[model samples]
Target: MKTKAVRMYGLDDLRLETFDLPEMKEDEILVKVISDSICMSTYKAVKQGKNHKRVPQDVDTNPIIVGHEMAGVIVKVGKKYEGQFLPGQKFSLQPALNYKGSPFSPGYSYPYFGGNATYNIIPPEVMELGCLLVYDGDSYFGASLGEPMSCIIGGYHANYHTVTGKYEHIMGTKAGGDLIIMGGAGPMGLGAVDYALAIDNRPKRVVVADISDDRLKRAARFITPERAKAAGVELIYVNTAAYDDPIAHLMSLTGDKGYDDVFVYAPVKVLVEEGDKLLAKDGCMNFFAGPTDHQFNAPINLYHVHYSNTHIMGSTGGNTDDLKEALYMAANHLINPSVMLTHIGGIDATIDAIMDLPNIPGGKKLIYNHIDMPLTAIEDFGKLGENDPLFKALHERVEKHNGLWNAEAEAYLLKYFDAEA
Candidate 1:
């Protein structure tokens, strides 16, 4: 079989090529990738290449596929897993394979098993570790988003608060407590906001603080304060850049009581320090962003850690259970993962889209593995509609959903741009 995929050759090098795939073993399953959400981690991998822990040192000769957040349909099930999986079944997977204590994952490690491809072979380790998931969602993008959403879910679950006298700590963010997300207007930050509101034990108030007014405004439009109120939670969007003393201004929102939970979405030192100051007694701060610098350091009040029960922690990726929960929530409409998406393109566009992800200035960039379109923002659909009828229709579909991407738009895109058509 032949597959089209973006391969990493070296640092700052990626090439989109079609190559023949070897015969699949009975223990391996072949799948047709439909949609994959480009991630910043992929950008990091490309920048570091073999130097990255997850990327192989022999990538120049044995280049690996460069996507992980993927969703698609099974094309061929191996004989060993005949009864468990079937052809044409929708699928997604937990990419954090933690297989045999190795840091290798699907997107960064495997050559023929990554997401940015028309077809991929599912390794036996994925099946054996129970990381392969059967997606029951209507949209492929939603399944592709499951991996990121799971990371958000894991952050929430990983937060812990301690009791005054007990040795065991309480897991999860404090229920009905004040919460704030610093630099929260970005894609994953928005996902955190969505999950914060949708969860059973909701926070009393959620404040999303960011420097960009445009990003904050867009986030508010998608996850509105009205929607938060209806969900029995208070939601506020603040442009922290506007205030001279941002920390003092944000702290004032909690009535000077401080926030029970603080999530720092950016890797900036100031953001981390500010989040540390805003923590209430027993407050748990989650450093959600991964910094590129290995020597990244920030100063926190150790006095508060000793006397005020303040603590800090971070999570890189979610476990299998988190991915399943994310998929279930999306399927049930408990949360809308589309809130993280802002752009769409084809397999041909992936190389450039990923190479220039930082400068793109939007949310998740979705790549349909079998199409040929350039990377186009959902907001630009209306303008592109002026010249192209496809964009005209896509613009109309998304306009119906408050200028957001949805399944209707996805189905239309697949039909008109079907690679096999």
Candidate 2:
């Protein structure tokens, strides 16, 4: 079958092409991508191309596809796998394949298997590793964002520590302690906030810090303070840029005891430094952002690391177990990663949208591969309504829900929008 996809060929080279996908083997499954969320890692892979660990060094032999956060439907099932998986069922992929104990993953390694394309082949290794997840959720949008959500959940699990002298570990985030989310206005930052608020062993106080007042205000609109209070969590949003002495302000909030867990969303040098400073005794700082440069350097307080028992850690993607947890949480309504969605576009504009993702000031930007449409930010629904009839309909449905993307808006787009170009 012929399908459209964005393939990373070389350094600073990404091209959309119609290519022939191989027939499904008796053990493989075919899926048609419905929804895919653009991730920062995808942009990084495009920029670095072969320099990226997973991307193929030779574009001719192995030009890989360029997206991982995706949800699709099974179109054809192999004869061998008739009982386990069937055709026409919804599914979401756990992109962190870690296949054969190699760093290679789909979207970065496999040419015929990736999220950016209209149709894809689920490789034999993916199913063998249980990287394919069944989606019974109401919206594929939620399922697409589950990949990023799983990373956040994995970070929380990795940040677990025990101050007790015994040779043991305390799993997950420290309960009843203060937690701080630096650069918390971004989409992944918002995911960490959602997970923190919804978890059973949640922190007593969650302080979300970001420089942009507008983004912070937008975040507050989604995860309202009232909702946090209802969960017995005191949520606070702070303009970290405006603060001359942020440590002083946070100290006052925590009654002199600093944060127990601090997650850094941005890979900025100053943000990491500031987040490291906010650690309490036995505090764990999770450096969630993955830097593009191999040797990205940042300063840390060594005294705090030794005397105060503070430590720093980093992680790239989630495991299969984490993806399952994310899907379960989304299905159960514990956390809606879609709350962070700010823009929607067809797969036709995916290359430009991804290249300009860092400059685009919004949360999650969703793309539907089979649709033919331009990039549309949710905030512009009302203004675009004045001229475009399609947007006029979008304005009423999206505006009523405080400018957040909803399942209804997605259904409308699928109904009215044109199919693949």
Candidate 3:
């Protein structure tokens, strides 16, 4: 089958290319992708070219399809797997193709098809691993968001306490704990916010700290005071330049106790610095965002790890359990994922999207498989459906009643003019 994908040819260059998909094996399932989302990993891998783990430096496989976050309906299930996953079932593909002797995983060496194209072939091993999650939604682009969200879930499940030798320290987001999401308005940071809010039990407060006033305001639009209050959680938006005294502001927010959990999502070097200052006693600081080469270093804070019982850890990739949980959370309306998506386009737009990462509106970028359909993000900036009275009424209600975040809020959020600011 001929399918289109955004293929990375060389350093900092991506182009839409058509490729012939291999014949489906007995254990494999062929799926027609409905939607996909551009992730930070994709941006970093495409931009840095040789720096990332997934992007092979040698480029032995030239023009590699560079996407993993995607969703689709099963089009053709292998005859051997007829009863397992039937055709037309809505599902999202999990992209952690590990080959290092993990149980039931198709190793990385094999050509594992991702979700960027119109179709993807899922190997029998992946199906057996039970990583694919099925859910009902209008577009698969939103479903693709699950892959990243699942990775966040897995990151939280990691034993960060063990890494820092804080044997007595218990890690992960806990009820009544303070969470400071540094760089909290960016896409991954916003994801961390969604995950932080979906803690089953609410955290004491979820603080989104960033240097840009626009981003903090953007964070406010999604996580409104009423929304947070309804969820039994407090949402605080703070502005703190990387060089300025952000720690003092964070300290003030926590009454000088500092935060219990901090998610480092971007500009990780700054995160390392603020981490030493803002982490509460026995706090867990997670490097959720992967840093670029030469852009990261282990903080020399042995005392904080030993005396203060600070825990440090990092994570990448989605697991089966995390995918399942993410799907459930998205379907049940626990996350309001639509709030995190900011850009929507097609395969050509995806190429442009990856290139525009540095300037991308600080939210998720979605690529629809059916490029012809109009981009319909559940955001406030775009005009509501003309004939759909329900959508129009909802838009008005959000703007008027839910004054916390609406069209005006979206405009405020999207304005990020001052880079030096």
> Using lDDT as the measure, which candidate wins?
1
> Candidate 1: RMSD over Cα atoms?
1.2
Model 3 quality (TM-score) = 0.81
TM-score of each: 0.98, 0.95, 0.81
Candidate 2 clashing pairs?
none
| CA deviation > 4 Å runs, candidate 2 | 418-421
Tens digits of lDDT, candidate 2, 154-239: 99888877656787768778998899998888888888888888889899999999989998999999888889999889999999
Which should have the higher lDDT, number 1 or number 3? Answer: 1
* Model 2 residue 376 CA deviation in Å: 1.2
Model 3 per-residue lDDT tens digits across residues 256-360: 998777777775686777866788877787777766666568564779878887777677766877888888887676765656666545565777777777775
Most TM-score-accurate candidate: 1
In model 3, what is the error at residue 274, expressed in angstroms? Answer: 1.4
Candidate 2 similarity to native, TM-score? 0.95
Residue ranges of candidate 1 with Cα displaced over 4 Å = 419-421
